[model samples]
Target chain A: MPEKAQILDQLYELIQPFAKEPIEFGEQTDLIDEVGLDSMKIMDMVMQIEDHFDVSIPLNVLTDVRTIGDMAGQLQGLMKDD
Target chain B: MSELLNKFLPLEAKRSELVAIGGADPFHVVVERVVSATEAIVNGQQVIMAGTNNYLGLTFDPESVEASCAAVRDEGTGTTGSRMANGSYGAHLALERALADFYACPAAIVFSTGYIANLGILSTLTGSGDVILMDADCHASIYDGTRLGAAQVVRFRHNDAANLERRLQRLEDKAKRTLVVVEGIYSMLGDRAPLQEIVEVKNRYGASLLIDEAHSLGVLGDHGRGLAEELGVEDQVDFITGTFSKSLGSIGGYCVSRWAELEFMRYAMRPYIFTASSSPSLIASTRIALKKLNSGTVLRKQLWANAHQLYQGLAEMGLELGPQVSPVIAIRLPVSMEEAPGVWGELLSKGIYVNLVLPPATPDGGCLLRCSLSAAHSPEQIDRILAAFSDIKEKIAPEKSG
Candidate 1:
């Protein structure tokens, strides 16, 4: 798997518990709609992401994230910044 | 801008209407009104108050009133600071000591509100990498606290120990750090948690336990110590968190544990460190209330009697009730949002007040008229409430029958 695909798979694994249905890892998968992530569940996912990647994602970033690709891109950006 | 605000508006507008109707205060003492509490006084009407949470009826007690007055006179209006700053005073320490003795625990930390107690304790104790196994029906405060802690929170079925066991079994070997949370008595459904089974599950999983005794503190146990003591697992549980707002007739919360290190969390918990400490008057009144709780077996008996009377009354009316009888008697209404408003309005017209709960607040897509009984309620008052319900049934019965 490519590096981005590997990262996306890890993110999907972290979000699986909170998702009401199976989540597909790709650029177009809407994080909130497909996974049924409410505000609380979204925060839970963010915390897990922070711990797993060892990076702090500000809560404000959640408002801009709509899809798995958005989240992965944000994570990648945070990793680069670190 | 207005349109943008509309987009964020609640979709359940009809349910809000029903709540508003139920809460409208009648201008007359005899009429049932939700918001106009003083209206009942003006009308000279015999209103049966079922909406209030004054379970022990201590709020009406002369002794409590006097104690509150004295505390206000002695301690002034507020503490005006956080416990981490200027919040802790002599009265706060005294109350903490009293709660420690009452629970027979080595350490007790008080919070400004019952909500904060859960928030402070849960958020501070658990963190990233820790797990929180909670009941699905746990209070919103507990859920928010777990969120604030940023822990991996998993919920089991409401009051189901076996499901909790199954969830715990799936946790990593590092599950020893997991925190299991449960409530002593659920607020919405008026049902008690299976503490014994939950404790057994926790022990088997090697997880720590935190039980929020907000509803059960003065309503359960021999000395009103709460579910932990009532179930004979007081020593087994790691922490007991409760509030003075419910049965104690005051405003504050506390968590007690045998672990001395629990006290250090007080310093780190943001809710405790940021919020202003509870007022001196509240602490004084709560301390007195605790003493009254310890000595007043008669009050508890009377409360139970009233609860049973109301439960049986509602049950005989063929109203759907909770699983087990408690001080809270929730009458499940037919699941029609349109019909609920009419019934709630009729109840208020009959001079009886009750809490109107609609989805998604109620479980299983039902509406609830939650009636809370108090120890101070006279047998006559309970009968009066039943009579109002009967009258309501008569008015609504024809609609259903037709």
Candidate 2:
């Protein structure tokens, strides 16, 4: 798997376009509200991330993910299978 | 606890907010009276309609209207039973034959609605151990059909042939078992699939291809066949599905194919068998509309002309538009979601009735004020629509060029 920091950065970049204001990604940062990502935007971002990382992140995986930290952890689990 | 109700609370809240912002109920903006193919009275105000997908504008055609009325009076209103039982009227078979002749395919099957055509065909054509290679942005019916078929569904990027090839390459026995599906013109974006490119990829991989010409029919090709015919890949496409609702100005769906084996779908397709067949009036009127769609060169030219006119007019207002220009001209909102419906409501109050598409339906998360143009729309009506936009230009639409 790629480095955690690197994955986090990619995740940040994925959502940066949808952000309402200048935002930063940290462990506890809410991916939805803080990043201003709607459910559809998140779905689009997840697909892009899956394409980039060569991993299949299912909808159920995202159901449990709320914060940037949760996303990183989920990505780690999915990429380990690869 | 009622688990279903609990599960739907979030959706309930979202819909409530959407309805609240639109002032009136957004879902049912009832057309109080339809004055013509392009004009309707909504909430007691006469409005120029840009929402109805009457692309060829045959709904109010005197011939179609007369024939349909006659059928309704003579034959009856409905089949009242599923086609599998006693519902296969003579008119249904006739429409199917006409569709097959129009597509120049060996066989065609007509369904009650376009939704059922996808549901029936996609399910019956595949099963367990087969795989469906679908576009990520495919219509919901396509996805549901795959689910019902119990096939492994893998989504490629929308309209990206390379992405499709990549998925097909990864599959074992890559070609023989995989079914790749795309839309001739995607309903949401009004963008077309690179059917020639998709066909090339499918052929190279030996995979079968299905193109849903739901939006492109009567709007794209020289003969109004669809995007596949427009791109000169009609013969190569394994299956072509389309709706009679939009261009035909009637309610029904059809799938045509060169393969004679497709006729066996009458026995195997559940959605087709279990559902009531289309009424005689719909079939009769649809037959009339199909002839016009096939032979009306002037109508096709006028549709494109109107499309380009509205597309350019919206672009001049600095509004974001769907890629290229077709009958469906989708204007996206660059503002917040809250403001999206407000703009839609405002447009309605100004004697304009267009679609207010929100999240999940739109390709991106953005909202859209989608307009479906028709050939019958007069130049004066087009001007009125443009002027309505001019009336509320800066307040709602973003100042983003192109």
TM-score of each: 0.79, 0.87
| Candidate 2: tens digits of C-alpha lDDT, residues A17-45 | 76778866687899787887777678777
The number of the candidate with the highest DockQ is: 2
Superposed by TM-score, candidate 1 places the C-alpha of residue A21 at a distance from the truth, in angstroms, of: 17
B324 Cα displacement, candidate 2 (Å): 0.8
The sequence of per-residue lDDT tens digits that candidate 2 reaches over residues B1-402 is 687679879877877787787565567678889899999899999999998988888998888988899999988998898888986778888888999999899999999999999999888897777778888889989977876786666778888888778767667483578889999888877888988889998898888999999998998888899998898888899899889899999899999998989998789888988888898899999999998888768888888889889989988888778997888888888877767777888888888899988877888778888999999988888888999888888875665458
Clashes of 2: 0
Worst 10 residues of 2 chain A by lDDT: A54-63
User: On residues B1-402, what C-alpha lDDT tens digit does candidate 1 reach at each position?
Assistant: 677778545754644565565554322223333232111431345456786777787764567778778888987898778978874788889988998988888999999999999999989898877778887778889978877887767766679898777667656484688899998888887798899988888998899999999988889999988888888899888998888887888899899997878988976899999999988777777877888999968988998998899888877776667888888788877647556756865776776777777666665556787888778788987888899888876533323343
